[model samples]
Target: MYAAVEETVQARLILSPHRSVRLRTVLSYLPEDPFAVSMAFPAEFSLDEAEDERSAEDIVWVFARQLLSSGLELPAGLGDVHVRPTVGRRTMVELRAPEGTALLRFDTTDLRRFLWRSRLLVPEGEEHLHLDADRALAQLLG
Candidate 1:
């Protein structure tokens, strides 16, 4: 059995080929769109703990695989996905592309609930981490 953490709702943006600048410009122009035009996570995905020491790189790789396999389309010929995990009170997962980087924050509470329901983890008390998916996406595109 693998030790799994709660799964959160993550948003991402698929960049156009060498169009990171254009994408950011368009996002800047459209300020009213709630749904950020970036990468988005599909319904099914999970992260499993590594057998060795838990490094930040390990975590990012796990997250990148989940995001890529979550039915989100990427730009043509894009390879070697780079992800940076911003560790803090609010953990931000940053996906780096040739043009720019997309950031995703985890909804700790909702993810916990989902994990508990999925039997991935035992339910403790109520704790919450509100992840702003839209804002993160917007920032990514911007």
Candidate 2:
């Protein structure tokens, strides 16, 4: 078992052709706007990437995949929040509550591909992977 400690959420979204992900902590909260990069974090976290010969993007993706695979915690308390995906990989997590206020933001590029490939940890295993990392992130975060 692992003791829970204060941690930050550090995530990186790779560009096209090789969309990948990375983060130091398990994501907890997501802002309403999917495109805006103002997501909330625990204010304490870290990031990791190996010395593989792959490009920086590839490294980030690999790290992200490892983290995502190690994690399966989903989101909760999202009843009226809205999720919006822009033209680019940018996504927004929105919430319009009538009682309280809490906000945080994070952005992801090509989230579906990232989630499918990363969670599966199969870089070149399949072309039509069937997983929704993007939706999971948005719903969980939002």
How high a TM-score does candidate 2 get? 0.27
The candidate that achieves the highest lDDT relative to the unseen native structure: 2
| lDDT tens per residue, model 1, 1-142 | 3233333344333334333211111111011221112233421221223323433321233222233222122221135343233334223334554544554444334333333343322222211122356876889999
RMSD of each: 17.8, 16.4
Candidate 1 has which clashing residue pairs, if any? Answer: 12-38, 12-39, 13-38, 13-39
Compose the digit string of candidate 2's lDDT tens values, residues 1-142. 2111222444443334456455342432112221111223222221232323333332110122222322222332235443444444444333444543222233443334344433333343332353457866889999
Clashes of 2: 20
What C-alpha lDDT, on a 0 to 100 scale, does residue 110 get in candidate 2? 35
Model 1 CA lDDT for position 89: 24
TM-score of 1: 0.25
